[model samples]
Target: MEKWLVVLGIWAMCAACAVLFIRGATAGSDRRASVREGARAASRGSAGDTRAALND
Candidate 1:
């Protein structure tokens, strides 16, 4: 019974780690997309004109 408890604890830690890794990966992609969009908006000179920026 003691060995089983240890095995369960190890598995729980592994699952937690996997969840965190997946969440981090997803957030990283979102940050990359946001940066790309920001760059495009900056290059188009939307900052100079408020009318040109629809989402802002």
Candidate 2:
């Protein structure tokens, strides 16, 4: 009985983790993409500036 309880508890934990993982993966994806795009744009702009400065 104790072993079974332990097994059930572990299973429930795993299920909860899976649910959270799915929710997290699906949630805020659009926001993440926007943020990623912004970061890439900023980096490109800065990189160009730095390269031009270095050449001069």
Candidate 3:
């Protein structure tokens, strides 16, 4: 029983770490995309749109 509990705890920890890593990875990609878009908008001189994109 004790061994099973330890195994369960380890599995839970691994699952939690995986979830956090995936979330971070996705968020990073999203941020990169937002920055790229914002830059493009700024370059195009769309003042209002660029402000919104950069704010993201």
Candidate 4:
């Protein structure tokens, strides 16, 4: 019973870490895209940029 409890705790901790890591990664990706969008907006001469921004 003690061994099972220890295993369960470890599994729970790992699951929590995985969830946090995924959320952090997605947030970073969103921030990067947002910055790119702003840059695209600033470059008013590029039609491709507009298309890419819309696709994203």
Candidate 5:
């Protein structure tokens, strides 16, 4: 019974680590994507402003 408990504890720890790693990876990807989108939007807005200025 003791041996079984030890094995189960190890398995649970491994599963928890895997879940944390996956969550971190996904969160990082999402953060990067949001940053990229924000930058793109800023650039587009600047370009539009420049075009309007040129027209004026």
Candidate 6:
């Protein structure tokens, strides 16, 4: 029983770490996209910038 509890705790910690890492990765990508879009807008003198613009 003790061994099982320890294993479960370790697994929970690993899962939590994975979730946090994935969230961070997604947010970083979003920030990069926003920056790219902002740059394009500034370059083109457009008032509106979007993620799709960066993607293109």
Give candidates' CA RMSD values in order: 7.1, 5.4, 9.1, 8.7, 1.6, 9.3
The local distance difference test score of each candidate is: 0.91, 0.96, 0.94, 0.93, 0.99, 0.89
Backbone clashes, candidate 1 = 0
Candidate 2 per-residue lDDT, tens place, 1-56, comes to 99999999999999999999989888879789999999999999999999999999
Residue 32, candidate 6: Cα error in Å is 1.0
Candidate achieving higher TM-score, 2 or 6: 6
- Cα lDDT tens digits, model 5, 1-56, are 99999999999999999999999999999999999999999999999999999999
Candidate 6 on 1-56: residue-level lDDT in tens?
A: 99999999999999999999999999999999999998987977653455557867
Q: Which residue pairs in model 1 clash with each other?
A: none
What TM-score would every model get versus the actual structure? Answer: 0.73, 0.53, 0.73, 0.74, 0.76, 0.75
lDDT per residue (tens digit) for residues 8-52 in model 4: 999999999999999999999999999998998878658877898
Among all candidates shown, the one with the greatest TM-score:
5
On TM-score, the stronger of 1 and 5 is 5
Error of 2 at 42 (Å): 14
For candidate 2, the per-residue lDDT at 52 reads 100
Candidates 1 and 2 compared: the better one by lDDT is: 2
Error of 5 at 23 (Å): 1.0
- Number of backbone collisions per candidate, in order? 0, 0, 0, 0, 0, 0
Q: Cα miss at 16, model 5 (Å)? A: 0.6
* Residue 43 in model 3: lDDT: 81
Ranking by lDDT: 5, 2, 3, 4, 1, 6
> What lDDT does candidate 1 reach at residue 18?
100
- lDDT head-to-head 4 vs 5, winner: 5
